[model samples]
Each structure stands twice: as C-alpha cells, then as structure tokens.
Target: MKHNELKTKNELQEKSLFDKTVGRRSFLQYAGAGAAGIALVAAGCKKDRGYENPVMGGATLDFKDDFGVLNYAYALEQLEAAFYVKVASAPPASFTAAQKAYFQDIQFHEIAHREFFKAALSTAAIGSLEVDFSKIDFTSATSVLSTAMTFEDLGVAAYNGAGPRIKDGGYLLLAGKIVSVEARHAAYIRDLISNGSFADLNSLSAFGSNNAGGLDGALTPDKVLPLAQPFIKTKISAINL
Candidate 1:
C-alpha cells in the first residue's frame, strides 16, 4: 500500500481504539479551558533535591511531583531527538531515498517535541542529557531502523504509563497528543521493518483478554528508565517517580 493509504488505515485503527477506550469528548474535556496556569502549577510542586548522577556526575531527576515527570519526558525526548538528528544528518548507506526522507520527518517531529517540553517546563526543565550510542551502528540500516523502532515503541509505552501519573489535566492532554503521534511513528516504523507487525501482539500487548478495545504496553518510569539507560550516558534516578 502507498504511504498515505497505510497512514490513513493506521490512524483509523488508532482512532477506533481510542474512541472505545477514552471517548473523544472526554479527551477534549481533559484538555480543559485554562492553559496558562498549567505549566506554572506543574512546576510549582515540591521537589526532591541533592541526588547524584552516576554517569555524567550531575544532579538526578527529583521525581517529587509532576515537574519530575515532565523532566523525565524531556530527558527522553532529548535522547530521541539527538538520535534522529544524527540519523537524518547521515543516513545509513543502504537506506533508500524514501527511507531517508521519512527519517528526516521523524527527526523534525522529535526535535519539535523536545523543544515543546523544554519550553513548557521552562526553568524546571532538566539540562541537556548526554547519550551513549556506542551500541548502535549508524552506518547499518538494520541497526538504525531497529533502534528507531525501539525508541518509538518505548516512547509510546512510556507515555501510556505516565498518563495516569500526571495530576494536571492539561499535561495529560499534551501527553495524549504526543503519544498518539509516537504511536503513529511506531506503526510506520514497524511497517517499514516488517509488513504487518504494527499492532501485533508481539509488538504491543492487547488491552485485555477480551481483546475488545484499546491496546496495551504501558511501562512505568521504573521499568522504562532502566531500558533507556543503555543508550544514555547520564545517570537517572527515577526512584521517586
């Protein structure tokens, strides 16, 4: 199938699941009317201070409140955006023109997300994180694409897990919007790697035994941070998350 056609189909499937699980009206309600105070309230929460960073020898994630959650997301986005920036700047030798183009788009999206979180968190946002991509072979399509798939899938799951933890409705809505995009990126990358593994049980868990609505694969900060650590040189302490 063509790219647009495939994207449309994937979107329809996601919309169906989202509608069944969390109605569109409900999601809109969560977005709420006030936006100006959302970030202020998020950042004003009490913070845990004085944790050591093992890898880069700096401060660790406070994880005392919602600001910690946003900072956590900021750290992840920084890693992702950096990876994609590298990939887009120097694509693998085996990559096709279309593949390079698609990666570039993903790179732009990630950078946008990173900037958004940075701006939203403002002074509370964590500093730039140092990443270790030593395990990845950027010259090889297999390595690059595999890593991309991992990041996109992990991002989706991370957002899913963090959704309930966000006390601010506006932040939840922001996360929902971003995760939907991440899910689409996951589906697109999965399709590029394998014909139809996007929503496969092997890639994503079912909502429940009934398999009626929504999809599963949410990972809390504790579970997610460890998996992401290998690619990051900065030590993160999500103990309080």
Candidate 2:
C-alpha cells in the first residue's frame, strides 16, 4: 500500500529513516544518552505495506528480537491511541466536560506516542496491527480510565525492565524518553481519577527497595502477546524475544 507491501523479511528489517519508532521531537528530547554510534533516520527508507502512514496498519506485526520488542511497543501505543481517539471523538454520556478535556489530552498524548514509535521503527517497523475494541469499552469513563491505567503502568515497567537489555544507544535513549513521559502521564491520570491517593504509583516499588524491579513484573513480548489477545484480532506469533 505505502510502497508495495514489504516483500521480504530482510526489507522489513532494513534500516532507513522510515523504519524507526520515535519521532524527531521525542528523539531530540529523549536522545540525551550517549550517541553510541547510531545516526538518526532519514525519511522514506522503505514504507510498510498496508497503510500510507507507518503508524496506520491492518495486519499483525512481527515482534521478534529487539525489532519485535519495539514493534510490541508500537502495537500498544496503537491500542492506546485508538482508544483515546474514540473517547475524544465520542465522550461518554456520563462524562463531565472537565473529564472530557482530560481524556482528550490523554488521546493527544497517546497519538504522539503512537507516531513516535512509528517514526522510530521506520523500515524495521512491523505492519499495521489489527485491534479488537470488544476487549475494551470506553462508554464507561471509569472502565476506560481503569484500562488505561493498567496499560500505562505496564508500559513504564516494561521500559524500565528493557532499558538494560538494549544493544543500541539510540534505542535505549528512545525507551527512556518515552518511558519517562509515560510515567509522568500515568501519574497525572492517576491523580486525575483519584487525587491524593497512593494509586498514583502503580506497583513498581514496594517496601522502599530499589533493586526489587523484578523481571516477572515486566511483560516480555511473549507475555504481552497473550495478555493482548483479548483486545486484538490478529494472531501475534512473533514475540520470541
């Protein structure tokens, strides 16, 4: 569709500006880490098959290895983005005007995140992912917000857990940047739903121990795929990383 479907797996893996996951704004802001010999991507290295924009898609993505991991993130952002977009487009009957505004901002943030990953993953990016809205219902703002909370917390911990394993400085920098922002977003939303409550910090730390950031708390591609099954229509089998 964009440039004829990525005909080969190698083409899908090739590095070009288009195959990236994060955007320039996110890249510049988050790339504070060492350069690590990686250069920024140029435009249009190779386009994905299903959509004109890399962020838009219709099929399942292949989340294998580091590429898989990035695509996994890309997919999640897609889900979040779509959810918020729906909320913004159609506010629930019970939602207050103030609540609508908050959700709208949340939608914009999630879209930014989705685009960020699309740009960052460029050619190495996965195909457009198919989602199942049935797994989630935004009609009830509380239910919608609660599901969002789960995703935000999961994203933060996943990034923190994956940071050390990244081989490329560029990738790691991107993760830290997005993860930090996600954390801030999470805190803001948590406070929004319930102010002055400890729910702000989702279960990352307990007992004041820093080293307790356990691997089990983090969802690898494999674990996340199954978790996402109910919300997605595609069969994601590439999370071998």
**How many clashing pairs per prediction, in order?**
0, 20
Each candidate's lDDT (Cα)? 0.69, 0.57
lDDT by residue for model 2 over 1-241, one digit each (tens)?
3433532333343334233433333334323422221122212111221234333434444433455566777777776676666767787788888877667666655665666666655676666656677756768777777777767766666666556556656677667777766776677667666886424333444212143442224545555556666776656665234
- What is the C-alpha lDDT profile of model 1 across 22-124, one tens digit per residue? 2122222322413333222222211311122323574377666677787888888888988987898899999999888778667656655665566566555
**Best candidate, lDDT:** 1
Candidate 1 yields a Cα-based lDDT of 0.69
lDDT score, residue 198, model 2?
Answer: 27
- Report per-prediction Cα RMSD to one decimal: 13.9, 8.1
Report the error of model 2 at residue 212, Å: 8.6
Q: Estimate each model's TM-score.
A: 0.73, 0.67
Determine the C-alpha RMSD for candidate 2 after optimal superposition of all C-alphas: 8.1
